[model samples]
Target: MSEQKFTVGSSITESYRFLADHMPHFFRLIYGPLILWVMVMVGEQILLIEHDIHINSVYFLNVITAAFAIVWYRQFLLGSDYASYRLLIKKGFSNSPLSFKRVSRALLRILVVSLVLLVPTLLLSFSMMVYFHGQGVPLSEAFIQELAFKSTLIIMLVFSPILIRLSLYAAGFALGRTSLRMQDIWKRTRGYTVTLWWVTLRAFLPLSIYSYILTLFLDVMSEKLSINYIVSTIIIETLAGFLTFMILAIVVAANAEAFRILIGVRDGDVPHRDGLKKNTAMPPQTNRRQTSKDIPQKTR
Candidate 1:
């Protein structure tokens, strides 16, 4: 069957329709890890206690999280049957058991990406230690510097999941299904990503403003000797983040996928319909008529 073509710059409603129409199996491409991460975060927070060992807890958590990511990645890739979009969507998004082999492969990619992101921080820490040792800094001072260095590592570990997920989505869109080169895909998508980022930031502006207002209210309540004001503020932040993510997910994903479709059409991967085709020149046979010239002459 010929592919259906769509024009760019269509309405927001149309964008929604397109996503609804093409509901690929890999739709969980963005949300699976997200749900896992939230659960992990909640569990970790709940388990924090004075009696328990907190030493290197964040580091261990990072390792475990990286493992989870890798496992999922492998499953996603394996289900794609070596990166075919159709197959990937079909198997990866199913309710059946995730392939153990895919999980292994995903873990490897996660480890590689994680290491690439971590190396710089690791080097900085080593350099700091060597420099401080050379200066004969006291043990306590040296320990404090090391703690700060490790804290930086922890921060990177926290944000690494977000970066990895975005990169995977971009890379998948670029290379996985359509067979485009990474560089070419990046060129097509870089601008879209920038635009999405700007729109996303704008979308969060309201939340930020509301957060400030809520903070002020909390402060007032605190001054007035109200209890659990912080709890209310925390709830607001949680709800705001969830709502912001949900709203932006729809807008950004729709627009991004729309652009992808446009790219595909431009490459002749999707064909325009007869009425919608643009070129004006007609074929010689287009206006041909049934003629009776020879028969009429004979009759005459």
Candidate 2:
């Protein structure tokens, strides 16, 4: 494995490497379906706004996104490896080739897990909404019932993808290289989750700062003689989006590396080879041990 460690995980260079090394076709894997969903949603919204039309297409579209999320999550988990990371970076700059089977598996898992997680959250949201409405209006009313149901369902839909990601991380710890059961994965990851969150917060802070500054600048600039504010806003938005995407990729890559390290431990690769028993794939740790010993001991 490369000794180079990514502190932010999805820094621009690491993100580039992640895609180039692991799955070159990752863009197509994500954006193809995403674009379709966006187009459908945008078109529906446009029609409603432009022509006083009402279409129930939003429900179907949400369903599709949830379905796609399920399939992608499972496949990614099953097929993930260090090789995937390496290949993502070394391959073509313009094209990334990822496996379809892997993609399909990931997507399928996402859908299943999303549903599992969404149910409880949805129920809670619905119950709260209904309780609030009933305090002021009749619970038996048709509109109240309908509002409660629809709001609950949409809340579930919004949460589905987040749930799927959680499930995949859980599943990966259970069956991926680490081979730890779900409970163990949970215990281990729970220890690391705070650290990961901190890192993510740091990664996002830069963008947030940039956005705030840009917005402030825009507010001031807008006050000046007429500016092509729309173009500047678009450019800023694009830059922000790209930066965010790169950061996300880095984060994903770092998690993948962390998982690999945990998997190594699970495979009986001890901190030092001497601590290990019998023949194994793990390399000897003579130099590592020597290096450890040369360090001045702290007076405890």
Candidate 3:
């Protein structure tokens, strides 16, 4: 079967369709990790409530959960149907989907890119600070702050394409590609950066709006209700966590879809009509008797 060529929009739509078709299975696959993550988060919240610690501690926990969630999502994308909690925990620490070597290389690449993009901005900011200080202008002035913010935004816009191009590394790592070098990913993603950007925006923009609305609603409820602030905090955190997971799932699915399409093109794999084969191997046979029972016997 010739591989069906898909445009960026079609590829994204197909990815959503694939997720919808396999929603139940995906939920089942992710439930274990999700539950564990929720538990950890709730526990952390409870501890925070008791100790009255700064919210920074919760941020740390969120980082941990996000890493684990990424690993689990990657495993699912790679067709792992069953992942034990122990394995998930271990993989989270080990960054299983991305090997240590690949991660190290990626980090190095990121650092180089960051320095290249950011060093000039940093230098400019430093020079501005020194000049202002010498001029008896405080660095805390609003003008200085706005300038810093604008500079950062400009840098981000400039580097956005490079970042998006490298974004597929997670999917590549998950798929266990032997050659996921930065240059290789860049070459493969050539001409598709804008498409990938569009797909990502389509996936996340609505979710962001939805989350903002939900947050406002939660805030209003907390204000109107007689419930304890802790209870409100927990509720807000739970909902936020759920939304975060949903976003992560969508991102993983979309990126996986893009990766599949790119790899298919690269390898000249015919896109079969079967719609991105989830299972490369043949399915198990059904019982002959059950199959026969479904067919009406002809009476002479």
Best by lDDT: 3
lDDT per residue as tens, model 1, 55-151: 4335644543333333323322232223233344445433234588756755675687668667766676667677777899755866966656785
The full ranking of all candidates by lDDT, starting with the best, is 3, 2, 1
Question: What is each predicted model's overall lDDT from 0 to 1?
Answer: 0.43, 0.46, 0.61
Cα deviation at 109, candidate 2, in Å, is 0.5
Per-model clash counts, in order, read 6, 32, 3
User: Candidate 1, which ten residues in sequence have the lowest lDDT sum?
Assistant: 291-300
* Candidate achieving higher lDDT, 1 or 2: 2
Question: What's the distance in Å from true for residue 12, model 2?
Answer: 14
Query: Model 2 Cα RMSD, Å?
Result: 12.1
The candidate that achieves the highest TM-score relative to the unseen native structure: 3
Mind giving the per-residue lDDT tens digits that candidate 2 earns over 1-300?
Answer: 223343444433333444454343345445544555555555555677778788886576555444333332222333332213233334311134555654576578667866765676567656866687768865556765676677667765665444323543643533333234545545545445545555545545665677668656765675574645444444444444344444444444444444444322333222122222222333557545544332121123
lDDT of 3 by residue, 1-300 (tens): 125553667766755655565555556655654565566656666777777664544665556555644554444443333223455445532346636775677578668876977897787677777877899976677978876877787777777778776557765654445366768778777787778888888877777789879978997989898767667767776677667666666766676667666753233221222323423343535333333232121122
What is the Å distance of residue 275 in model 3 from its true position? 6.9
Which prediction has more favorable TM-score, 1 or 3?
3
lDDT of 1 at 165: 36
TM-score of 1: 0.43
